[model samples]
Target: MKITCVGGGPAGLYFALLAKQRDPRRDIVVVERNRPDDTFGFGVVFSDATLDNLADADRPSYGAIRASLAHWDELHTHFGGRVLVSRGHGFSGLSRQRLLAILQDRARELGVVLRFEEEVSDPGEALATSDLVVAADGVNSRIRERLADRFEPRIDVRPNRFVWLGTTFPFDAFTFYFEESRHGLFRVHAYRYQPDRSTFIVECREDTFRRAGLDRAGEDETVAYFEELFADKLRGHRLLKNRSVWRSFPTVHNERWSAGNVVLLGDAAHTAHFSIGSGTKLALEDAIALVDCLGAHAGVPEALAAYEAERKPKVLALQRAAQVSLLWFENTERYMALHPLEFTFSLLTRSLRVTHEGLKARDPAFVREIDAHVASKAEAQSGVRVVSADAAPPPPMFTPFRLRSLVLENRVVVSPMCQYSAEDGRIDDWHLVHLGSRALGGAGLVITEMTDVSAAGRITPGCAGLYRQDHAAAWRRVVDFVHARSRARIGVQLAHAGRKGATKRMWEGMDRPLERGAWPLLSASAIPYLPESQVPRAMDRADMDQVTSDFVQAARRADEAGFDLIELHCAHGYLLSSFISPLTNRRTDEHGGPIENRMRYPLEVFDAVRAVWPADKPMSVRISATDWAPGGLTTDDLVALCGMLREHGADIIHVSAGQTDPSSKPEHGRLFQTPLSELVRLEAKVPTIAVGNIQSYADVNSIIAAGRADLCALARAHLYDPYWTRHAAAEQGFAMEWPDPYRSVERYTLRMR
Candidate 1:
């Protein structure tokens, strides 16, 4: 297969390298506008996972990139004097020039012909030269425009104007500094590119740009403005631009990505707003995928079909996120003027790729602690999730359930996880695999983990929440595909963990938050999960009522999200559970006391939730069934509690165990607490879904067979095998609908059947 990649940037070079690797005999040429040494941008950051993807596709190149990487483990967020440094953000800061040089060398070594300083304006040059022409000319790709009607380019000019500049200052970590200059809330994303210089990208919304008159300002003037914005941090290190050739990057997005023999790759296909620092990653990844598709498929049309089909969703998602980042930066005036904290959080979320649930894996402590914040308990960010028959499988676990109107099928669920890979709060390529494969696994129900109800509810500095219009739009592709591709039902689990926060990630040591118990935990009563955790503030009467309403309103929003079932997280030691657990509830008010009293606030939460939840659909409650501590709640307590929940319109009782008490020793084992689920099933007489360590086909079938529970949820196992459901069906000789794409794999006629 012969291939011609236009533009010598990361995408083209990487694609050329990948193509040659796929077929050494294949003639591949990379045409660039600049010399081998010449390149734009300062540095590009790639996470550990991105490296793994590269390694998976082309290990030699992966090893080469890794070998040359300037590694950084921690990401530092600057808020004036307060510096929040969190570890394990996992990015290697390699300069654009360095990245190109490496790819240039790798492509050359891999037998890729690099034709530098060759500006061919016509597609005929690509057509005449190679079997396939990749339209990777960048954001303003003329090849894509020539076949504009074929590609269907939906060019969305982003609002915020940003300049990608470099500096010689030693920036070892990714630093986001907010400046409330007369220019307004200008945020600078500065991170190390080389050992001496850092890539300083000055990003500001349209309002700030206009107010500062940056458009009219000369290149040096903009740099001066940014220097003033980071006055003390710069430490006299000068910021430099390639001003001899003027460039202020306008974030570009295209609706239609590929057409005919020519296909778009990288920034030419889609541009991720600079906030998330993944422009090059997207391009390189496209190159990798296109090559694999060419190798995998038999011919050009099929390869193109597969590549476009694969890359389109990915590019669109990234573009949507870029749009969000662009809009958020452009709308900074709105957030900065009214809600600074929210603005900052929104910025963090916009650059992120994965959903809120992913944070549990990436940085559990951050997610936990954020769930413990004030807005978290307010219930404004969580509510009932709606799912239509038209809705696709969310993540992997999706099922058409039936309880009044709520229906889902399948038991596997992609527990919500966050890919804080965003610069601001947008989804990107990382998000696609982070989500799509989970759906591909055939889980009946994949509920996105606890998505922050509001931007502020996001755990860590990086949990992605759906609190804005751009958020909804950004997620549409994710939700749409899960529904279209699989039988799985998709739903978003929204949560606000109140006051249980302030720490590094889970792997880092899910530590007790900053100020420990001093950050004022808000609950029905003044109770702390532990002395090291925050000492929760006793909720005043006003707080209680307001929180109840917040839950209601958030639920309404969840309905707008088009989720299928609404699961109010009254479990996992979050705020709702705080009110239910005796260990945390010390109040004598209507919201606390005996089981009945303890049930009040949570019930009020449920009732408020019920008022907004549809009368027809089934509502579910996930509870810590047993608090484990003797004086806390008992299994009997959960049964009664579940009975009450059923009375309040909850259809499924998702039974789990402990969290509130520090001394609670959970009896740990495989399906150790399944008996508790049995009790909840028989006693409560409501459909019960059992979770925790139920990891096999036998377990799922037996649990449902023995009537211990109506459904069995397999979480960790699903992660281990996304296609577990398919494997299970084949094991059981049950005919399941395998996706059309994989049907060929089913033909094993050598004697097995």
Candidate 2:
């Protein structure tokens, strides 16, 4: 079999060497448009784990690379007139030219042909001639462009402008330098890759670049400008250039990594943002995975499929994390107002890959200092004196949070989870056990699932409701039990299913219309929730009035049932949410079209409910911060909506995302919705409850301590462990009150701890 690799970068060269080593008789050739000695960029960094993989794959090249490496274990951040050094983050860096040289030599030694100064404009010709064609070209790959439709590449050019250059600074640790200029905030990422040379990449927003005249400045002039801007940290070092020019980082992604006999590798297939420093590492890892897959499979198609199946998910995860880090740098100004300690911490954990516990493991003393600082501030704000300053206070999750007149014992909330066990809008034993158990589990607040406002508003026949007197009486029984048995405050989420109504039970087939007894639906527009679902009648003035009246009546019942809080469920493609999302609400009347018009009806409903509900009790609104689809609500739109809600007497905003359309693409992961919560909380200056995949106490602590959200809601985790909060308190060694009946058990657990 003959294999030809395009563009002789590390990914292509390494693959040539490994494939030859795996099969000595295999014919392999690496083609490059540039000379063997010529390369762009200065140095590439890798983690200790990556070094281990390299050593296992090919020891001689790994040894050569390791000998050339400049390693460090400290990350220094120079910010706010102070330098914060965090340790135990091991990284190794080597000059890109040297690394490529080593791979080129190894490939030649393994009987692989290297062709320099040869460009392949048509990858299809190479694919036809050879058994396999590997496109390992850089971010702007000609072969990828030639076969763009087959691969379906998606390239996102980031907002900030960055220039990659080198300096003779001799930096011992990976360093981040941030400076505030009249133009905007400028940041530098520098790390030593040789005894005397370091990679220095300066970055700033586009507005800042234009303000500083960097867009028009020559390469030397740009370097000079950055040198002056970062002079304090750079000292007297000279900045060197190698075709370094101001440009936005293009994050490349391919829907299909392979088409026919051709496959993409490294930057050609995907590019993670450089903020995480994983571009080279991922490229090499892809090379390794491709070689292994080829060796394992007999057919080229099988090998390509297996390679993509194994590597795509991992690359996507890293890309997602890189995106988070990129966004953090783009919006650094938002966190500039934070205290220096928190600012430094936020910088260190920007990617969300690292956690408070993980940081503590790496550098216990540093984490302890941060904990002490946070505890001091928390104490000052709460006026709750710690019994012992010598002992570290409980984790921030244990800290009490105040919402208007209500003071929660902790920041943990049991997010509303639908049970679909109610009968004709009346709560049954299943509802009682579900809500009552979480309350007993020691959550600060327990919110009921989307309880319909009227019979026609339910998503299914089993959905709980607050419309009928029987429904109110049934809910009162459960609420009374929780009030008597636990200190947890309960809230009711009053919702109208709108176009999503007349669905079968979730266990049977969620959102599917019932074979019989399916009622007609209504929404802001005459649209169906899905292609097969019922087409909802466009709500007229009478329909809006009745819905608003139903919500007011539900609020009255919720109050009478002794619910401590009321959350208007206007999210997740519900009735009010239908009006907010452009994809669902296509009406051009006074109730839709522009965002202001789209928000009109929801605001009216909120106003009516606020007028009827008790003034002292807080009312929260659950909103889908983004539809996660094109031509839908965005974070900016949600922020504006939140501002309007605040003006209309909303006490809190519950932040959730997506489910507005079937085609919506949600970036799912742990704490995925927290960023939306952070934006709304800061931009709108409204307290927020963050819900979605919040799994642990550490997450709760991080979200609260970082000011990302005032409270975190856990759903599935609570279903698996009803005593999640109690166990969290135990794990953190904090004393919490238990019910009288469980006092003995609590005592035993405390003693065991």
Best by TM-score: 2
Q: Model 2, range 600-698, lDDT digits (tens) per residue?
A: 999999999999888888999999999999999966788899999999999889999999888899999878888889889888888899988787787
Candidate 1 residue-wise lDDT, 1-753, digit = tens: 678888888888888887887779988888888788876677888878788888887777678778778888766766645565555567888877778887888888888888989887767767776678998888888787787777766655645566877888898888877777776776678888668878887766667678887868887887787777676888898888864223345555555555557778887777776766678778878887888888898878789889878877767666655655555455444443323332333344543343234433566454333333312212221222423244222211222345565445555455555455532334555655656677777766776656555543444444555565565555566777777887776666655566554444455445356533223346656656566665667777786776666666667766765666677778767777887888877777676677887888788778887887778756777888887877888656777889899888887888888866768987655565565676677667878878877766655543443345666676677667777777765664445677898887565433566
* CA lDDT, every model vs. true structure: 0.67, 0.89
- State the displacement of the C-alpha of residue 134, model 2, in Å, after optimal TM-score superposition: 1.4
Every model's Cα RMSD, please?
Answer: 22.7, 2.4
Instruction: Quote the lDDT for 682 in model 1.
Output: 67
Displacement of the residue 236 alpha carbon in candidate 1, Å: 2.2
In model 2, the number of clashes is 0
